[model samples]
Target chain A: MNDPVAFVSAMKAIGAGLAMVSAIGAGIGVGIAALGGVQAMGRNPDAAPLIQTNMILGMAFAEAVAIYALAVALIIIFAA
Target chain B: MSEVETKKRRFGFKRWIVLALIALGVYTAFLGPTIFRPISPVVVLPPEGTGLEIFGFPITNTILGTLIADLVVILLGLSAYRFHKSGQIVPSGVYNFFEVIVQFLWNTVEGAAGNKWGKRIFPVVATIFLLIFVANLSKLIPGYESFGQIKELHHGVGYAPVKLFTIGSLNVYTIDKGQPVEAGHADEEHAASDDKSAAYSVAAYAEGGDELCHSCEVVPFLRGAATDLNFPLALAISTVFLVQVFGVWALGPAYFEKFFQIRALVRGGILGSVNFVVGLLELILEFAKVLSFSFRLFGNIFAGTLLLSILGALTAVLIPVGLYFFEIFFGIIQAYVFFLLATMFISIALVSHHAEEHH
Candidate 1:
């Protein structure tokens, strides 16, 4: 409590941890995307390749949110 | 019956080999004096200086890694070219390997974009994938992020360096997992007096005995190229730049309309104003694309390298092997993701907004 330096470091650590909570949204988004893709593929197996490709694209977009969170977390830890 | 017997025999032999390997791995994990007690990897965000200068510019380890990846790509290209130039009807070896990858990528691109546009985009997207794939996978090579020059540690916490061996005049050193030398009273005094602004002490080195060499840490000669933000940022910038170029080349002056929909705002009333706002958002999203692309690749590979190092430091044997295989799969998937995204972006840019409205 006395050391301002330690207190700032602790705050940065906590901030970084909080930043990563955004990844939960990304995880759920990706899972839902996959679920839809799988069902579509099952319903129409012939369109599976196209569906798979689009599915991956959707997943990547979903995952980008988490990547942003990771970037923020990293910046908080290392640069801030 | 004979064919079935042969299949069973082969399966039995493979299973025994796998079992023996597992047993050997377990034994090494448990019994062997841990040869690779990697000093809780110093997670230096910025690439470490190699102390080598080219015309006074300091060379960083990530630059070295980038060069290595470039060299590998060049070699692969040359080898594949040589094999092709041989005019062999059926390709073998390296050319065959590249052929499968190229064919698969080409098909995907063609499927997404028409054949004409796919041809134009394929080379750029494929090259990015190959380069990123090489860079990501190169980190798994034995010496990377491990072997390096020993330097005096400037921080509070650092591992003690053990002299591995000597060759002629140079002494090889590696960090031992023994007691880490803490920041001494001198460092604390330095921190308290001179460097109150910074959280950590800016002291030159920690105090330690000659035998332990606790003040030393290794600055690795090569790190994963993508681990550095600059590499991915450079790639993302160029990719985005190329997307704009492709857009302009395909749509001429109409490409700018995608970003600025002034005509829509002037004529279409409420809906036109909405279109203008949407266009502005699209323009903003282009910039966001760069951030997402670079960060996605960098975060994945950097996290992967960190995971492997931490896991290796923790459990030096069987566990890391599984993780290494996982990393390999993850690396390829990341490379594919990057390629797929670039292809999609370029393909999207090729289409006019008006064309999409009609469809």
Candidate 2:
């Protein structure tokens, strides 16, 4: 516990773990987006391609949040 | 009915093959010799130096990957150009394959951004998709991040190398389950530096200790290009810069109006002030776009590589096969996502603020 290097490394590990917690929000956002897209496709199956395209685009945007969190976690573990 | 029966028979045959393979995997995993267990790779964040230099510039493995990816893109382009020059009315073989991809991409671009702007943006978007897709998929090739120059590990812990064989002067080696070198043993070997036979002996490996070895490790010749931040960041910067260029080209000088709403502020009303603030936020969001674009691609590809390596180390056979397919799927998805975002941003930029307000 007295070793500063060990203490700092432990803190970084904890911080990296905490950063990934932000992925929960992105998970929910992506799920909701998928739900809406699937429902829209069910309602109008003829527009499936358009709906699918938009659905992927929305999921990418939502996933970007989790990607950001991952970046933060990696920076904490490696860069910092 | 005959066709259906044939299809069912083929399916059953494939199922048997799969089951036999899985059974073999189970046997190898549980009942195989200790040597069959793969050495867990030492994971490093930054790309390792291959000890090669170009005019004093040290070459990293990721750079090698980037060059390979570039070569693939160039060769494909050349092939496509040759196919076009041949003037085949009905394309076939490799040309047909290229045609399908190009046609699909063209339709997607044209659908997202109407015919006019889509034509202008298609080249850049398609190039991004092709380059990224190739770069990401290249990681799955055998021997990537595997075969490399063996360098003595000076600082960090490394696995004991098992000598595979010797050809002429070269002694080829692969790692075994990591056995740490004891401090006393290491020092004794260092003292007897002149005796080459005293170094890296089988007896040392046989007498394993709790202590870790700062021994030799392999620095792979090639790593996934997107796993490196430099490649992704460079691509993101160029993509964002092109987005701005497209905006300026479309809207003329008025494109600047999106970022700085001085006219709105000059109106001196509460709503006008809100509009001006929103424009400032838009400017910040443009910069944020660069970060998001780079990190999204980098994080996904890097995480995929890490997952693959860890899974491969844990179970050397059947499990990683599924993950390889998953990585391939993700490679395509990430490439398409990047392309789609770039196209969408360009299309958004093409529209005038006044037109949006009217809508």
Candidate 3:
């Protein structure tokens, strides 16, 4: 038969790319979150630091979703 | 007003000003760790471990890093002390730098421990924090995680090989050049020394890779400390035991009455069987304290380390930089949580039994 290695490698590439699609949610979510935080900072400059700290915390929490997605994708691509 | 009252007012006013300054310091630290709190790595191990070691243990760059970091911090502290004597105006530069860390850790420990006991634990917690925090943050530096090797080792070399698992623990032979070239060892000199051939055949972790981080590839470092699971587990066991120890210390032999509910039995006399049973349940819960302390710290930090690895495998860009902020927050929280719970455990141990003490 033709090289199965070529086929498996192609599947992983596709899977890795697809797995990274999970970042879209994170990207959109983080962008919107940043916009919200920036707006709040504009309204209250004093509150900006606390708000930003919380924002990063929120973003980290949100980023965990992307991490979860990446993990799923990684398991697909890397694991036998 | 009396002289004492006037003096008290002055002191209180100064205290408030100091508090504001501290508030500013903390705010800056949270928003911008770069300005104030950047940690560096330490190298512990030396270079002579042949591609494969004559001894059973594996030696790597992290070992070297840990030792160097320890040496620098300890030596720097000693040097700072000698340079700045008892109450000249103030110390500057690295002396000032260390003074700030001392202050930060002092507050962190005291905040967690409360005034009395906090002072005692401050040095231990603060030292560990300074060391680990510096070590952790240093991982961000260009060469910190990048010094490790990527070698394809001969998996099964004959002599005295274990029979069981084919995959050796030292599967990836990292010629770990863990330390930066010392002041004494010039770069050219290092390169020249075939004698101290630090096998630093390192691998570059590209943007977006695999399960673990290329830098921290969860395989295991040569120098594992109490921060490791075994250490943490021992900490957990001791802490939980310490809780009981302190509890007994605070309450005396009667503290066991907490477990037995002899007080409740005495009050209820014949009809206290249900309450007695409930007391036994509380005893069981105390045992779970060990599990809580161990797993909570291990899980969070271990996961934090894992997450960073994955992040490295992903985009090596502005994104991972953001996660550095997240890791700082996560690191502080985990450290504080460990300290706080330990404090609470100790507090529980230390607290005097109101009813019995009065009686």
Highest-scoring model, DockQ: 1
Question: Which has the greatest lDDT?
Answer: 1
For candidate 2, lDDT tens digit of each residue in A1-80?
A: 98999899999999999999989999999999999999999999999979988898888788888888888888898898
Q: What does the lDDT read for residue B36 in candidate 2?
A: 46
- In model 2, where do residues sit more than 4 Å from their true spots? B1-35, B154-156, B181-214
lDDT value for candidate 3?
Answer: 0.53
- Superposed model 3: Cα runs more than 4 Å off: A1-80, B1-91, B95-97, B104-115, B121-132, B139-146, B149-227, B266-282, B354-359
Name the docking class for model 2. medium
> After superposition, which runs of candidate 1 have C-alpha atoms over 4 Å from their true positions?
B1-36, B183-213
Candidate 2 lDDT over B1-359, as tens digits, reads 99999999999999999998877766655566543465556677787887779999988999999989889888878778888898867777776776787788899999988998889999999989988988999988988988886555655555566667666545666655546544355555656773774455434433331122346567788999998898888889999999899999999999989989898889889988999999999998888788889999998898898889888878877889999999999998899889888888888898898668658
Q: Could you give candidate 1's per-residue lDDT for residues B1-359 as a string of tens digits?
A: 99999999999999999888877766655555443444567787888888789999989999999999999888888878898688778888877887888898899899988899999988899999999999999988988988787665766676656667766545566765564666464345444675563433222122221222345577888999999999888889989999999999999999989989998888888999999999999999999889999999999998888899888777765788899999899889989999999999999999998878768
DockQ of 1: 0.82
Per-residue alpha-carbon lDDT of model 3 for A1-80, expressed as tens digits? 29898799788879878877978998888788888899999999998855765565555445545655654555566563
Interface C-alpha RMSD, model 1: 0.7
RMSD of each: 5.6, 5.0, 17.3
lDDT score for residue B118 of model 3: 73
Q: Quote the lDDT for B208 in model 3.
A: 14
lDDT of 3 by residue, B323-349 (tens): 778877766665544554565556555
**Candidate 3 docking class:** incorrect
Clashing pairs in 2: none
